[model samples]
Target: MNRIAAPELDIRASADEAAPPLERPMRITILQGAFLPVPALMGGAVEKVWHEMGRQFAAAGHTVTHVSRSHPSLPAEEVVDGVRYLRVPGSDTPRSLAWLKVLDLFYTLRARKALPAADILVTNTFWAPLLLAGARHLGALVVSVQRMPKGQMRWYRKAACWHTVSSAVRDAILAEVPGTEEKIRVIPNPLPESQGSGDDGRLGAKEKVLLYAGRLHPEKGIELFLDALRVEAVRSVLVREGWRIEIVGPWSAAEGGGGESWMDRLRKHAEGLSVTFTGPVHDPALLRDYYQRAAIFVYPSLARTGETFGVAPLEAMAQGAVPVVSDLECFRDFIRDGVNGRIVRVEGESGVADLAEVLQKLMVDADERTRLAQAALAVRTSHAPERVAAMFLKDFALLSTLAVKVSH
Candidate 1:
């Protein structure tokens, strides 16, 4: 990789001796690929993390800047919640294919020219760690956050460190690039606490309700969710008990959705079933309410994106809802079968049958639900954003310091 040379600076001697500041905060910049930041609450999990983490880093006294796709409604540059937002090209378009990485390549080159000097340059982009490797040579500690298991070691060779979202991703990366393990760290996504739930870890003032919140992509497994509901035993309980299965998300192509046609297809399949598609609740408060009310939460995502670390189930867990997810290695990073939540096997002879059976169990037995829900609530504090942010800052600072020492 070609290294970018740092600019030469002229130092002048001063007559008076002055003491340096006791504490200096790190200057951090996050490249959010093509995700929007401001007025981008509904979809795009990548942007959601940048917005939240940017604010937390800024609040912790670090100077933070976020570079993401720009919106016409949002300004080209502005400060929100202490983080400075810098808009780059590619807002008019969303959900483009891998070819769009060409745009990302150009964007990184453009950002390198204009972005202020930083101690840390963090990116969630798959090829960015390698694409923007020159930033590391310029004295910025380049960190790649592996949100999915998609690429090889070449993509991460120049990164100061790779923050894997789960152990599955960490192992996958190590399998291909065993030499990078020393520079890899596993950090789970941060969770914001749920509101409106009572002290006893109980749910809303209603009956049995099932909930699903995420993108309406095929990999997300909305069809599987509807299929599980087709089982006679599961269907009987939902119909007889007057329960509702609510699917909440932004299923439009612009918001990284599977497009309206696919959503329409899902609705057709859900016909005659007590299913409600409350398409993409933008308000965080309203989303939390849905989590708090739903007694059973199901996420059967079978996407080929490696179905990396998920944030939806943890949010539902915080709201005291029992989560029933497909057997994804990402969920296993935290969820324990019949403990904090239940994981259904989706590969065997009775895949759908097992899911339906688990849903029926949660619906019929309140004690098991209570036990899991309470344990779910108990984990919220440990994964709180504040604690997660502190861990992130510590890891970030340590890596940056090490880079500076090596350069010296």
Candidate 2:
């Protein structure tokens, strides 16, 4: 087999005394899933993240290419925000997980030929790491594990590095496939830079909206949110104070949501309450507006296995909405109980009371809510796009150096 050609590392110091050293830029390729589009016009967390990161990478003088499913409004191949976007024939999400994986396999095969010559290939796809493990054209395979691993990590041992969005996901990978600790790297997802708006960060000035932004699936605990609303204390606050819950996200299965049947159940459960379903808002500005206007952001996810890093909660917190999340270990990386946000313990079925209590306190106590929201702003700088991108770049540089040494 031919040896991969790694990018040269440039660690030359800057001319200015205050400026940082100039680093080398590599050709970076990011392969997304077959279901979502690149520009994130249809709304997928991974898509939006990589799209933004691709732009950031390109802005820093790196050649970034993002390949994902094609959309009607977007060109099949075009350069946007300095990043080259290449789209291929793709399909809507299937109802069955097995079928989705099968589709992913076919998509991966198609996406392989579309990949340009690159020094580093970053992907969260099911088959990219397996298919391109020994590809001579691509230099380090960075497998981004955004979700929990289910026996898949065993096959991905050959990857140069495994990027886990949270420590919980890294732990899951080790539990399923041990002895890969040296290959794993924990990096939290970054907040979108476009989320910056001139909106007031004051909690008292925000709307009386209690927001829940994510896919309308059972795993996200939408029903549990409604159940919490049904609690007499929460209901009294809503009725007396006129606080409304706005559920935003795709509800159809095609957009990676619980199908209509699940939505029907949610509607039935949410009866006689001040709830509004805004459907799926794909625009970043509009989504940020929802986060901006809301006083509290509630994400009661029960997907212990499926939930990795809570991007929605992070985005909400960025907009100064005090996040109320379930006690999932993935959330612990950013959310601290009663500090930046509230973590309600979800034990089987008993956690609803705890959820209700937290909501009631936030709704009633303005001082406490403002304090948490102010603290949450710390994520803006901590998980900023530049900071996260720098972490990836450092890892890429290390991997490239290692590859060059091995090749020699």
Candidate 3:
């Protein structure tokens, strides 16, 4: 397929730069999927990202409208934080992934009727790219590929641009559908300012807590984290030193988790460890409190294909917690092994032992932990919300200019 080459995007906007004039604003529409609400009350990563981005876009003098699922508490149509939100009747997340896609298709059909005219239509829904292919009045369709595509990219040929959060996702798409290099752009997620903000006293009073946030799924390597804690060396640190592990996030299959059976299995495995299973904390300000108090954060994800990006660990890093992650290509985009964070090779039977060793080392060495923690704080600026929003706006500007679709 022949494609129009993407224009060079300049996203060098800093804190000192002036905002765009209100008279010349881009009309932007963000369409979220069927499950979560706009304010991200239920803790969906994709929803939270676009929600924050929508607010930032609006603040930067763009006319923004965010269309999302309707919640009982939220109004059907209202403006919050400078962005307009339109909520459509939506369904709860079903058990099966296949069924979820079916619901997304139906929701897209419903949402299509409510969409307003815009210069750019940004969406991460399963069917929006294909469904809105002929929506010329809604302007350019910029699909946010937040996950690895399952042979869906070829059908989304009408998308003006594909925004991927990391090179890992971008490479996965290119591998699945060759000749799509020109239509893809890699933009890292921004660390919400709330996650990075806290008193310096919080950093100084970091506890001996190892934090693990995100869905309680098998692919997330929670089982591996449990197995590592079962190791005698790690158990010694937890028992003798009074160190504790906190496993946070939802565990139901409907909430993008591994199901209740998986959660039960994890609980059984963690019989004697100092592990606490704290459920999902949707509020960013409250989640930041957990990150601020933790001395270390671990995300030993084993999802080679399912894991697109690690947002939880990044938030923890912003709060000055030293991160120890699995050796995933997605994490390499931000985390440099032994510099800002530790990356453990968890590929084989020795994986548990490898993870245990890293945990034990960080648990004992306060100085080394502080060193990595300080360096990890740099993500505040690198992945700052303002900086990443600028990157997206740049791409949106370029794609809007080259709205003519070309394919062979």
Between prediction 1 and prediction 3, the one with superior lDDT is 3
- Model 1, position 386: C-alpha lDDT score: 62
Clash pairs (backbone) in predicted model 2: none
lDDT of 3: 0.85
Can you rank all candidates by lDDT, best first? 3, 2, 1
Instruction: Please provide TM-scores, in order, for all candidate models, with all chains considered together.
Output: 0.88, 0.93, 0.93
Worst 10 residues of 2 by lDDT: 1-10
**Cα RMSD (angstroms) for every candidate in the order listed:** 10.4, 7.8, 5.6
| Model 2 regions more than 4 Å off | 1-20, 194-204
Per-residue C-alpha lDDT of model 1 across residues 186-295, encoded as one tens digit per residue: 87776753232243535534358899998888888788778889999999998888889899998888777889898889899999898888888867789888987889
State the lDDT of candidate 3 residue by residue for 61-108, as single tens digits.
899999999999999999988899999988889987798889899999
Clashing pairs in 1: 219-303, 249-280
Worst 10 residues of 3 by lDDT: 1-10
TM-score of candidate 2 against the unseen true structure: 0.93
Question: 100-138 in candidate 2: lDDT tens per residue?
Answer: 999999999999999998888999999999999998477
Candidate 1 least-lDDT 10 residues: 1-10
